[model samples]
Target: MLDLRSQAAATRRAADRVGGLTHHLTLAAAATLESVARSQLRKAQVDPVLELASNASTAEINEARRRRSVRRGQDVYLPSWREAAVGLPNLFLRSALFSVCSAREVLVDETIATQGDTVITMTGVQLWNYDRRMFAACLNYYRDDRPLSSSAEHPWVKVSLWQLAQDLKVSYGANVHKAMRESLIRLNAAHLRIRVKRQDVPMPRLIDVAFDDGYLGRDTPAPLLRGSDTVAFRVLDSMANLFGPSDWSAISDTALHERSGLSSWLTGYYSTHAGPFKLAVAALHQYSGSICELREFRRRLKNALLALEGEDIPTDCRIASPEISLLL
Candidate 1:
């Protein structure tokens, strides 16, 4: 009986020691967790200066964080300043949708090569370099400086006609305002049909909208403005999708606005490429959407290439008989 009682007492002592060790381990684990949580909280804290600059509400900040966590990739945002540069889709730059000619009404239905076996069928009024500038200015106003949760169907901006003209470096007058309004209408009328065979993706239109002058809905025409009259410009989801990190290039605003005709087009085209590459002059001519004869285009191309060089864009034009090519 005595031996059995001694053994039982030893067992109880062992169990007590085990319980004490377990309690210490649990407390240690809880302390470590608290420390880690505090560290994370500090790291997640928002900078007050950045918060002020963005002018975002607390709910907006939380929503942006949630969206960023859920999205697969980072969002591409435009620069804050107009003079810095603007993000333009590579597909727009590489194709002949914007014709390198004077503003004229056009009806086109043609297939243009882009990526491997990917062709874009464009059908709309022939857009000019001037229109391209106007489109860029609109994008400038749609800068994503703050976390903007907009409808995926259409993201829009409201800016005065005078502001747009200033961004385009044009004198804002009654006549200029009328012309700008017409240009936006033309841009909205254009359409692009992208057929991607490799990925089996088909897209409908490039940009699917026009401007809305405040007084247009009541069956009354809005008068031409001196300034300060706002117009709503909306961009389609597909068009907005092109602004993704991989699909667009930052084009120099100064270079684009300074040059005109083929030179202006070249500014955008070369901006898409990182370095110079050889391309046939014939292909360039077709891509430029120039109505000039091939021979005449070659002459103009040479001059345009020189002008681009002056704008700090390096180029080499090889005038060989069999085929003319450019290292742009």
Candidate 2:
């Protein structure tokens, strides 16, 4: 009887937490949409559409207009991290890499990734969630620009750490600053080897094309980062190619901020293709961040699917766990 009562209380608490999160996410999504609409309106040279004649269709027309405006004004481009090639959620840890929360240095010549015919190796370094955010931020920064050739001076992009923290919905603190610095170190020290079918591109480390201004070494200065500090980094040839607009994915800021990293990655991947996409449960596990064991992951995935149903968010995808299919 005591066990039963404990389970019931736990269930109620979980329900309450989910409800609160859902409400907060809903409000955030609405605010983002409103901001986007206002920005579009200000940028418009003239009224977007004819004032519709019938009052009955006015709501429908406005909704349609809003959808079109969002597509036009608020599109954020992201580079594709396809699972078959690079591995899904490209920077996350698999069971083979390290413990879920550990920051231990990976040994040199470690096989960090094995996708299709490609096998990527890395040195002793840890890639954390903050590193993932930093990379995404950099990619988004240069999304609209053309990738420069090998000879051109690398384009330097300057961004304030505070603004980046806000965009990522991460708290700004000394630890955050340290995390950012560590991310740069890990990324710079990493290497990649790509082999597709029978062909191979020369393997290259990320550092070949990217590096910070002057903060990598210990002698740089104390408080290596600050809210007001602006860091400028140049994107070189290979780096530009890495972030180049080949096949791209789109993930909304609200989705990234509100959902788990796995969910956000799944959303981005699904957004790339039209669904009712069918796949096995194993593939879903592999593609999403490999955090939880299968049983727990399935439970979490089911809840995500249920919560998404009939929600007013932008995704057209509907997920059902029993069938293991996503209908978009």
Candidate 3:
């Protein structure tokens, strides 16, 4: 009994040490983020367009000069002050079925069979992708310190469909237009109620919200939305808090546009950490956007790991089988 008690005491001490370390790390990270925020705000005082134009190639400068006489320190392109940020809940990031492309009501709750008005449901995949796209663009705009305009109704951030397509790295076509239109409708229509587990209780209700004001047009693309030949869209005021001082991760727009769903998941997983992480295959499968059987999951995950070899994942971090460790 004495020996058992000593062992238990040792375990408790170790856990306490780990907890203290975690707390310290969290404080350090918070301090770093605060410093970054201050620096970004300071940098915002300068005209970012001049920085871009200064770095442009001679040919590019000549083209801009031909269009409109380019001055040494004058702004070439107007900086977008519109901040279109979306704060996604942990539930939405981890397990929400926002990427189901079909129009059918996606069942979010595992225990519940039929989705009633109370049960959360995602509209489609386009909205899911749009959420990430807009979030990234908003972060970029914030980082660039774009000048805010006097538009009240379209306040958060205004982006044209063509620019959005370019950001998404997809060629604009009829299908793209249709998808954009339908996604705007679905995003505006989506209603969600999130429930989270707390130490005080088994489950605590977080927030009940809906996405609103998706597009800036009537039925079709406006002649010139935001001075561009594409449909204009704005971030909802409700989603504005997502841009506040919160946990944010830097996601590569290139990876997001180029990689497969599973590859993208791996990239995100790696971005969350600076070193190796040991996660179970089951957990990875759950987090991966790939909805497939165990065999198929293994196959795809292996391919994703393989694809990451030359990029972020170290060559030594190769996975020979299902039960393997990954280091990025």
Candidate 4:
């Protein structure tokens, strides 16, 4: 009877704590909504099409416009016009959307990324255009990012960068523009084609134009139109606007999440429970060696992340015990 009562009491406490959190979260959400409404109402005061802060609709706007008074002979009268702006609501929503973006936790693969190392944040889709001849030609797609080196392996006769640049210099003399134009022309020639092999299978007529850029180390954006010899035309934009920027409005929430890398990043992070587990493994190495051996320590780390660290033992993982997942 005592054990039953203790369990019941523990359950009640958990329930109460959860209830408190829910209430606080709801209140916070309500406050945020109210704030947004107030901001929109303030903005509506000046916008002609937006419903006035008074919540007046299109009819009200027409009536207000019609009611405007003009001076007749010596008599003069005026009507006060309220603000109504259509674009303000959209601006508010976009601000909210970006808030969501900023709230997401940053996740990184430790194997590929080091702690404190800078990694590319894929907040949105990157657009690229085909125009490597002159980097400046792709200005429309420029965004702030350090240039990264992109390389590809070549055959026996290595074309050193210095040699290529020197050859271009001598051939084009002082006219850099003309040299670039002629180089692009040479790339366009059909005779310069490559064959790509995939899975040891030969593919017909493949264009092996590798792109290299200096933007990864530089604190400025690389030109988006830096396509290689095979690229003819291209443009970059949010994958959500694959059809075009004008079509972006039609993209649904579900579609946006899938197209954007953000959702995938979250789902992967949570299911994997990578960050916490890593910290746990590091902790185990500090104390007991045998009973708390490295293998056993890893088991504890894995179990903890699944929310079953002490409750349910995991069958397949670095650690088999459930006790590891308890955030210990």
Candidate 5:
């Protein structure tokens, strides 16, 4: 009987030891699976759009949610890293929509360029490099305000003229207010058209290109004169589409503000190209809509190239008889 009891006790001890061993094995297996899951998460590529949405403030998130329901997926938001940059359309930068010169001539279906089967045309008062700068400032404000995203049907922003002058790095005064008013009018008045022909298609398709519809003042009449007054700037659906994810380039505000006139235009032009090649001076002159003679433009081009280099942009000007080209 004593031997039987001792054997039974030994068996129970061994069973307990086995149970404990099984428990430890289970824990080890669970730990291994958890570690693998963590490693996989670390290796995964995070979606930038989702990350941007996640990092927004609570108010912004709520506002986005509210707007999402109202606009149905029209979320116009930029990543935090792009705060120092201004987003502009590649088509606008590539073409002479904003001419390098400050000529106020009215253009009616003026052909800007022809790329293969695509022909770009512009109408209304000529836009200059300064107008480009003002447009940039307006875009910056629109982004900052985080207004309710509007569809290609309707898009607008209510802005202050005084604040716009500050954005342009100019003093807020009568002259500055007058200039801002004129720029706003010009941007609203300008119209662009891009016609593309496909070999398989019989007719060319025209892309939508109403840039801006003009400004409406709150208390005063259209094109408000008071620097402190607010104006409703209508950004057409076509213009808003230019700010779409694939169509725009982020231009450095510092580089753009530091330069003016032709140099500034060059800065924006090159920002759109990832690998810039040698471009003929004649081509650039036509693209810039410069009123200067070819010889005079050559001198200005050299200076513009130097100015770009000063802003840490490398350039090589190739001068040959009967032809001049530049590589950036």
Candidate 6:
């Protein structure tokens, strides 16, 4: 309890600092976005060309065949911000969905579903879920200062200025919100020469590191963690000091199994690395401590697995969860 209390305090401090920055950055983005919208509207009114014309048509996608067919010194060049701006209309529609987050709502229309009057039925559970995801993004970026992966899937639903005030109904214990804050701060720091539907606009932009790293356009994923040698060494040194360990053996099995201990520590630590996540999973390996925790955790995971049974959730997709755990 004391540890959680301290964590709550520290998390609050971390969140406040990031959230303060995020608030200002988001305000700035709102202004910039309004200007961009007006500019886009003007362009649309003036230009009749929609989609790419024969003269302007670049390759629509990065294809293996296309890669093999490119001529020497004439590789296909896409507008730098190819898909970063693709989600604007979708984002605008989703904003309306978030606007209606009331306790009276039952089932959430998480996806916009269609382009019509988007009224999402927000449940308490879904609201809490959205809140947690936002808190995670803020903390993930601010305190952890980590790069985000596509898997991270930080929510981009910007609550309008009025809606934001309402969304602040809950305070503290908010990882997702912290991540949102950090992501916003990062976005506000970068300028993108975006070509949305063939018009150039230099705007402050936010993109998932996957997109920013050229995952979609370039097709190869980029590293999600960035740090200098000194920073990396300091992180290692900090982990050693915090857990009072240099190696796996030094961390007691019991200390590891305690959710408040190593496992929790590594959930934030080595968050992007399969190896450290493996180590954390191994720490849970010998845990025969309680049937209830195992059952609850396993049941939740099983349900999640079932949802993705026919979906592409991994590299090879041949192995199941426990089998993957064995590899861990």
Model 3: per-residue Cα lDDT over 21-62, one tens digit each: 775665555555556655665564432123334466756644
Task: TM-score winner between 2 and 4, please give it.
Answer: 2
Clashing pairs in 2: 106-124
**Cα lDDT listed for each candidate:** 0.59, 0.46, 0.42, 0.26, 0.58, 0.27
Best candidate according to TM-score: 1
Candidate 4 TM-score versus the reference:
0.15
Residues 77-180 of candidate 2 have per-residue lDDT tens digits of 12333222121122222212222233556667766532234444556475544455555555555433233223345445666767667656788865665566
> What are the C-alpha RMSDs, in order, of all predicted structures?
16.6, 22.2, 14.5, 24.6, 18.0, 25.5
Error of 6 at 213 (Å): 38
- Model 5 agreement with the true structure over 1-328: per-residue lDDT tens digits: 3343455445555455566777566555555555665566555523222223434665664454322211124454532215667777666776777788888999887887522344576777888877888877866754544543345455556657677777887878666665777787777766666643221211111121222223344333434456666655544323443333344577777655666778777777766666644677777787777879998988998877655554344332111221224321
Error of 1 at 59 (Å): 16
Model 2 regions lying over 4 Å from their true place? 1-119, 124-128, 146-153, 169-171, 196-198, 207-225, 239-246, 289-291, 310-313, 316-322, 325-328
lDDT of 6 by residue, 1-328 (tens): 3343454445445454566777566555555555665665665443211123234333442231121111112222211111111101221221222222223233422332222232222222222223222333222221211212222233332323222222333332234233333333333333322233333433222332211211122222324211110100001111111111111111122212222322222222222223422333322322211123544645443444343333453322212343434433
In candidate 3, stretches whose alpha carbon ends up further than 4 angstroms from where it belongs are 1-105, 108-131, 134-156, 195-230, 236-246, 311-328
The whole-model C-alpha lDDT of candidate 5 against the native structure comes to 0.58
lDDT head-to-head 4 vs 6, winner: 6
Model 4 has an lDDT value of: 0.26
Query: How many residue pairs collide in each prediction?
Result: 0, 1, 1, 24, 0, 18
Q: Once model 1 is optimally superposed onto the true structure by TM-score, how far is the C-alpha of residue 252 displaced, in angstroms?
A: 0.8
Ten-residue region with minimum lDDT total, candidate 2: 68-77
- lDDT by residue for model 1 over 170-258, one digit each (tens)? 88876677778767777877667764422322345433344545434333444635477767665543344343334567777765677
Candidate 5 residue 174 C-alpha distance from true site, Å: 0.3
What is the TM-score ranking, best to worst?
Answer: 1, 5, 2, 3, 6, 4
Write down the lDDT that model 6 would get. 0.27
Candidate 4: deviation at residue 187, Å? 18
